[model samples]
Target: MPTLVLLRHGRSTANTSGVLAGWSPGVDLDDHGRKQASAVAERLRPVPLAAIVTSPLDRCQQTLAPVWADRDLPPVVDERFGECRYGDWTGRKINDLVKEPLWKVVQQHPSAAVFPGPEGEGLAATQARAVAAVREWDARVLESHGKDAVWLACSHGDVIKAILADAYGMHLDLFQRIVVDPCSVSIVRYSETRPFVVRVNDIGGDLTGLLPPPKSAGNKDEVDASDAVVGGGAGTV
Candidate 1:
């Protein structure tokens, strides 16, 4: 069995502005996001991760930088984990697009929703692609390092949510319920059996019981969940 840790990138300016920044170049993490990433890295230091993977997107890469550097591990960038191709909606205000009739379909039925306009990739398409990518990563890591290997993936909220829903038995509708806060980490263990979530929406990195003791030698049990918030988005990628 391998334990997979999915890390959502820290908050970006696009997130605060309510814009669809799919593949947009300027969607980097803000100062607060950088601090959050550092906190998460400190909390995750105890986990015996065999590899750290990330979407090639700048935000994802930035979020993983501190943790990756601390562990002296380089992140394996995978294009498959990149965000949904919003096409024409890229760099547009989320509120503006939701007002459109066609975009409403996504709000009501994300599993079947398709992006309108040129070269857009649908929810179903992203689901299929990301799932395959995760499976491939799991297979390769497990084959090379065996079941005890722990893997971390730095990705977007929707991407992590969708992958978790597919791998575990979580309802697609409850996708909105899983709060992936900026710099938050979710852990899942996978074997011949289905995956099980060890923790969800954990912020400030309290991995006490879940992680083996680290050389830093500090022990703590209390974790504050105040940083998490309800999903305001009508639909996810």
Candidate 2:
């Protein structure tokens, strides 16, 4: 299947304010975040993405603005990729939430955590929908663009973390240990057998590695992109 590049949106005004800002409307990227967004364009210049998907929230859209500029790939907005519905916790300060008893449950056992109020979504539910979204997209991209195709999806921290957990087969309770920083990029490639997590929570690194290697004169000698290289054999050419 095609390679999947997971990007967490850049820092937002809520981040500086120490607020949760879940599903908040006006949370655009802060100055530092805008810079990070611009840098993403340069880092990804050498790679050609088959598709770009994004959460409908403003911050995730803003984070991809530079990457989409002067390009034909307008981002496809997917609601399932949106931030976890925090319900009453939306726009609340993180400092205050940490003091709440539920915060410990969220950190120590997210699988058992459920936000308060009718609008609130359970952590387990978030994981289910998000994992399904990526898996669906991966299949679509692979069929439309071929095995070597690379793709990008810009989303929130928790959403990306949940997707990564599914790829790694890790329980939701252990997901808190994974840190997806602002504007960071993670990679995953799905094969017929299983999903391979190539990288995770990468803030900055060489992205040329994302590009598929050149094809040989004959297809007979081609190696399967989905196959893991034993002894971490020579990386992408």
Candidate 3:
């Protein structure tokens, strides 16, 4: 069995600002996010990693930068691991959108919701795409590197949870229960026999004998024009 780890990027500028950062363009990680990724890297330093995969977003790469720097590793950027596309809702303040009727419904019923904009991917589509991406990546790793290689992936919060749900046979409503904080870690075991969850939503440096064991982890949207074309991306380690 190969150990597959999915890590959410560390905190970003938009995360601290309380804004919705869908597929925007330039947002990057904050200081705390960097620290989180650094901590995760330290934790995995001893494990020989077969590959470190990430979303093609600055924040995601930035979060894992410290880890890669320390371990002398490089990550393979994959578009499939990107965050959910919120279309028109990208780059706007969360408070501003929360008041909109459609936004409220989407937040309350994300599984069935859709953003009002062009090029926006629905929750179903987002979930399906993320699941497919992970599966492909997992298959490739196992085939090329053998079954027991340690695989790591850094991705967005939504995509991480969606991937978990699909792999573990959980429902989308349970998505609200899983939280992958910036720089948090989630582990899954992939084998020719089956795929299993090892942990979910674990913050790096939190396992200092003070944190609880990994459990069924418990724990997003849209756009803007004049939006300054704010950028968005994914994170992982």
Deviation of model 3 at 149, angstroms: 1.0
Local accuracy of candidate 1 as per-residue lDDT tens digits, 21-140: 899997899998998888888888876788888999999999988988867779999988898888888899988987877675665577777776796888778878887988888888
lDDT of each: 0.78, 0.90, 0.75
* Candidate 1 residue runs with Cα over 4 Å from true position: 171-174, 212-237
Q: 1-237 in candidate 3: lDDT tens per residue? A: 566788888889999999888778899887887777777878866667778999998889888787778565689888888888888888888889888887755655768877778967887778888878777887888788866667788889888988887767777756766777788888877655456676788764433221222334442133221122246323123
Candidate 3, residue 133: Cα displacement in angstroms equals: 1.2
* TM-scores, all models, native as reference: 0.84, 0.95, 0.81
The per-residue C-alpha lDDT of model 3 at residue 189 equals: 71
Q: Rank the candidates by TM-score, best first.
A: 2, 1, 3
Instruction: Give the higher-TM-score candidate: 2 or 3.
Output: 2
Q: Candidate 2 has which clashing residue pairs, if any?
A: none
Can you write out model 2's per-residue Cα lDDT over 1-237, one digit (the tens) per residue? 789999999899999999999998899999999999999877887889899999999999999999989678999999999999998899899989999999999999999888988889999999999989998998999899999999999998998999998889899999999999999999998898778898898888789988887768887755575567778887665
Query: What is the clash count for each candidate, in the order shown?
Result: 0, 0, 19
Alpha-carbon lDDT of model 3: 0.75
Query: What is the Å distance of residue 181 in model 1 from its true position?
Result: 1.8
